[model samples]
Target: MTVTYLLVDGENIDATLGTSILGRRPTPEERPRWDRLLSFARDTWGQPANGLFFLNASNGLPMTFVQALRALGYTPVPLSGTEDQKVVDIAIQRTLDAIADRDDDVMLVSHDGDFLESVEGLLDGERRVGLIAFDEFRNTGFTPLKHRGLQFFDLEHDTHAFNSTLPRLRIIPIEDFDPAQFL
Candidate 1:
């Protein structure tokens, strides 16, 4: 059996999905269904796999979220620092380096271009590197990675498995408002 490792840049993915699909940042109540995501990855890759979810410690995520991640079989690796410092990126690189010699395939879940070089190096070393991100967000930076003949899976194309029903916005007419009721 071929073991596969799924490394998720949690913040990157959450931001992209929130801005592109949800039209805003996803609230804690709108968290992705982890079981669905894991199932989708397994089906897409055609193999059993392990998942590592990297988050920014500075985000101040609640303990409940951490427990949920653990329950869903995701190992949460949190990096502490501001965004500009590239702390998460560094952690990702270190992780890649640590696992580069392993026989298992690696699937990175992020649209950040910073990983281009590391991914390219892995490909050059004969490691199968797969990128999982929203297709709509793949811009110029992603071009080089694609040019290198790496495989990519767009989450946007697979929303049925990646997103829950987003809350719809509702508008009310001025005449329907009753501000005086509170007084």
Candidate 2:
């Protein structure tokens, strides 16, 4: 199985997972286990992975987060502006469009509702799209989609294990990673 692509919503998923499980900012003590998570991604669909991390370019992202993902073998794609502008969502859609014609599977990492249409389109095009998120509540209108093989990652269940295995993870504080306001 050629695991073609994996899209990650860096801020949304990480922030949610960190707060709910870590109870604070993520520590460097969890790097290796996190690496194992990436390893899970690699092994789940088989090798030769194309990982893309989606972040908001306008609201800005932390360089450390970008670098961390890059180190994990993911290409970071930052979309400019807000969700209302839908730039991040649109970028992911375009990427999906590029591969929709091919027989490839995509792993989407987000709880954002905006992806419903895009995910539907991918599924309609015969692409196996897997939704990855840490959200435990399943009745958020996306349950139907989840039933269609939407993968859920319980940070609560996995974080401690992740932390125990992976320590000394490189970190960039949010305050330091914020972008400068030119306006």
**Considering every candidate listed, which one attains the maximal TM-score?**
1
Task: Please state the error at residue 117 of candidate 1 in Å.
Answer: 0.7
Off by more than 4 A, model 1: 28-31, 59-61, 82-84, 163-183
Predicted candidate 1 versus true structure: per-residue lDDT over 98-151, tens digit per residue: 776767678888888888777776775455678877665754476667666678
Q: Candidate 2, TM-score vs. the true structure?
A: 0.65
- Clash number by candidate, in order: 0, 7
lDDT of 1 at 145: 71
Best by lDDT: 1
TM-score, per-candidate, Cα-based? 0.76, 0.65
Candidate 1 residue pairs that clash:
none
- As for candidate 2, its clashing pairs are 28-168, 28-169, 29-167, 29-168, 32-166, 33-166, 57-79
Model 2 Cα shift for residue 128 (angstroms)? 2.9
lDDT tens readout by residue for model 2, 1-183: 646577766566556546655567766564224445555566766665677877787866779978877786778887787557867777877777776777777876677776676676666535556666554522265667665655555432432325453222223357646355213
For model 2, the stretches where C-alpha displacement exceeds 4 angstroms are 18-34, 59-61, 82-86, 124-126, 137-139, 146-161, 164-183
